[model samples]
Target: MLRISAEDDRDVAQFQQLHEDAKKNGFGRIFRSTFLFEDMVKSILLCNSTWEKTLAKMVESGKLNLEEMERRDMTAEQVSEKLKKLTGFGAFVTATVLMCIGYYHLLPSDIETLRIFRETLETTAQSFYDRFFPFQSLAYCELSQLDYKSVSGCSHIKQLKAA
Candidate 1:
């Protein structure tokens, strides 16, 4: 589903290449959920917590009736409202779940992710979104693989200094 189109410009090509290389190196594919409720809860746990903490929270939360959530066939708005009721589920977390559930237009632009974009790409979130748009998440995933030191020393920094 995440294929690189022949018509896509240089940015998409870069992302596609990075994603392919990562796959070859045995990086696991991004996680998605068949059950909406599970994804909703996972998104909540992902907020302001480590992956270990997310797992621990899920385990502590116990069994959920994913079938019921599916059966409800709730609208994105409804699901967002429900997520808001949970502790620690903020606007960004709610947006993340919505995005995970196939709303590609929304960027789950939290503080940390924004900081990474600023540091690495040297761009504002709105500008980054304007350029990358639907592929922003894919770009973020690829960029996340870079070492901080290497990124800091990247040629872009040299170009910026020259300018």
Candidate 2:
């Protein structure tokens, strides 16, 4: 998990490559956790539903090898599959956990994502963020940050390029 933020240098480089404005306004990273399992638990608790008992039982019974995920050997797809196998983990939960664990290729799209994308990108379409490739989730986070800040007088994400 330590390597996650250290390796973000590459993501930052891609951020610049995707948009020069990214270089002007530095990206803000919210610290999720020092361990992948910790992040999985935290994101799961915060995202939606009451899967706490299920997750707790799985952990207590050793049915879920959350620590092994910290090895960082597993691909995002691999982690997603394992998480999806969890009894209460739906698409959003799985994707949220992956994102919190430093996987940026997936989006945990929900109503908020839809509202922001529609207002900011002016589209109800999907895959419009494909240009960001594996960094799409981070890009979405940035867009949301912009939208919120704009409500308080900062520029919206759509105007971020010119900001």
Error of 1 at 32 (Å): 1.0
> Which residue pairs in model 1 clash with each other?
none
Q: Give each model's clash number.
A: 0, 0
- lDDT at 66, model 1: 38
Model 1 misplacement above 4 A: 1-30, 48-72, 120-163
What tens-digit string does per-residue lDDT give for candidate 2 at 31-87? 667766666666667565576544778777888777776555788888888888876
Q: What is the C-alpha RMSD of each candidate to the true structure, in Å?
A: 14.3, 12.4
lDDT of each: 0.56, 0.65
Candidate 1 weakest ten by summed lDDT: 1-10
For model 1, what is the alpha-carbon lDDT of residue 1?
A: 24
Deviation of model 2 at 111, angstroms: 2.1
